[model samples]
Target: MNLRIFGWSYAVTAASLVVALLYGGWEALILCAVLGILEVSLSFDNAVVNATVLERMSEFWQKIFLTIGILIAVFGMRLVFPLLIVGITADLNPVEAVTLALERRPEDDPTSYAYLLNEAYPQIAAFGGMFLLMLFLDWVFTEREHTWLSWVERPLARIGQLNRISVVIAIVALVLLATFLADEPTVVLIAGSLGLITYLAVNGLGDFFEQAGQKQLEAFEEEDAAGPRNGSGPSQLAKATGKAGFFLFLYLEVLDAAFSFDGVIGAFAITTDPIIIALGLGLIGAMFVRSLTVFLVRKGTLADYVYLEHGAHWAIGALAAILLVGIGYHVNEVVTGLVGVAFILSALASSILRNRRLAAQGVETRKTADELAADHTSV
Candidate 1:
């Protein structure tokens, strides 16, 4: 509740809105504000997932995530990525893509540049949807002592005992999505497969480095125990560093990209002006999300609210479902966003009730350092 962390986000929002007004006139300003709300409704759970991973990083890397990572999230995903997609899909060079985007508006004409850009939606949905599905599957399948939606999650976790079941389920879902409903079935299948591969590579690499860091921590601890000991153990020891930190950082970017896939496409419905979209969604919405993520980490919110992370993954799962379904049909953006919000809010309410019940019973629920720390000799 300090509110100080969001100072930079507020400044950027003002500046971005001012640019929207001056360049785009009052209508642009209005759309900018509208897009901010849209982006938030679409991506707040993205921030929560980010916090779970980012809280483990060193302070220096955390700064890198905010600075360099913001640039990637804003410009890389919001701007360059769209352009890149158009270029590849339309077989246009980069300059031609930029020229087309500058010349034509989709809101007005059927054969406009924006039309070409919008045509790439199915591929985008496939890639982002599969990636997120993998993330949700892995999390739910991994057995954990604590769970928020036990009836649902516990059953999924039990199924996880079958090795690589998450991958199997994801593949089945992808096949169903592509073969049954998608217009460009082959293209969506390839895109979704790439998404699955990307998730496996990044998650596998991050986990490997995380285990190495944990081993290093364990070595330090054993050394500490052999010699003179402080009453406290090495509580401050880093769970992830060096390569582990880099891979985790990479994972965060992929997660952001996946989360933004639909949000970026959804912005087209409001305006085809890429600049305004970046300013509204990237500069304003994403900036606030990053700040909120840091706030959650610094405040120890996740540790206190045990169900929050579970809620986020559940929201992610819902978002993935929406994206996959959207390939065959147009799903309302509000519906997509609200499904995520509902899951998160319900999870938060459950966490509060659980906390109160534990307090009355003289029981505790805060995650032990080890529980939160797994992934390194576990963060």
Candidate 2:
């Protein structure tokens, strides 16, 4: 319980509540709190995934994520994004739509926006399903090498520079969906395309930065070998570190947005009040995520549970698939939770069994050594 982190989180949560209350009064406050809690609990896996990215970032960037990044997540996605969705789906002007969301009478049915968004399920399903499929492919391909299924990925690997091609194909598919499939598809298309493209673009940028980082490391090492080693100049070191941190932060934010997609949509299942949704899901939920990140970092949870990262990645993949299913099929939030829990449990059990076997082998080795010593003594 680092008081500083706790204090900051408390302050932010209170501030958000106060703002919501000022705008919408007591009902809004209550809804925001509920949404926040729901968002936090549902997003437990989000913190784990974020930690993977956060750990790689510099301290300054990590602070920025906790500070600035949280605001973007809370306001931009949780608050604005849904209203934007409503505006598109209902053919209303964006400002008018937002005003409607903000000023709708308390007694008025809150499900109006939810109903509109629900109508666009097909597009959501297509985007989410394809995204999940890509994740599964990456996982299966990556793990095959570890499990002696290297043969499977070999052919795929031969299609050199596939990522760029994949991006082009995804763009094409989105165009077709927007052109033909959607009723009022532009908004959905724009949102989905932006999400996908951002993922690809950020990943590409990170890879580029990584390569640049390696080059810099090599140059420094060579320089060191040639002369009496001088400590790295502060400015040069800072630049390199800043570049790495920025890349990592960007990567983390993209992943965070992906994790929040389902949670944001699912919040609709609970309530259509944007302010309540933001307060409940964004402020409370995101604070908990930040806290969870700190907890994981402090406990070194990722290092302890070797397969937990695998489980999280798998969970994310499943969620992505579920999102796609929303296009033509209805998906329950409970089903999403159960499926993720099942995969995680299976992965955890496997890890435990593997560790147990190793422990048993160690015990057998010790017993054998003891027996050999007894025999030598008798001799």
Summed backbone clashes in each candidate are 4, 10
Model 2 Cα displacement at 164 (Å)?
A: 7.8
TM-score of each: 0.93, 0.74
Candidate 2 off by > 4 Å: 1-34, 88-94, 105-111, 120-136, 143-194, 228-237, 360-379
The TM-score of predicted model 1 comes to 0.93
Give the number of the best model, judged by TM-score.
1
Total colliding residue pairs, candidate 1 = 4
Candidate 1, residue 336: how far the Cα is off, in Å? 1.0
The local lDDT score (0 to 100) that residue 320 gets in candidate 2 is 71
Model 1, 231-338: lDDT tens per residue? 444543443557777888898999999999888888888888888898999899899888889888988888888888888999999999998888898898888899
Candidate 1 CA-lDDT value: 0.85
Model 2 C-alpha lDDT per residue in residues 307-358, reported as the tens digit of each score: 5556666776677767754553568876776777766666667656655776
Model 1, stretches more than 4 Å misplaced?
108-110, 223-240, 374-379
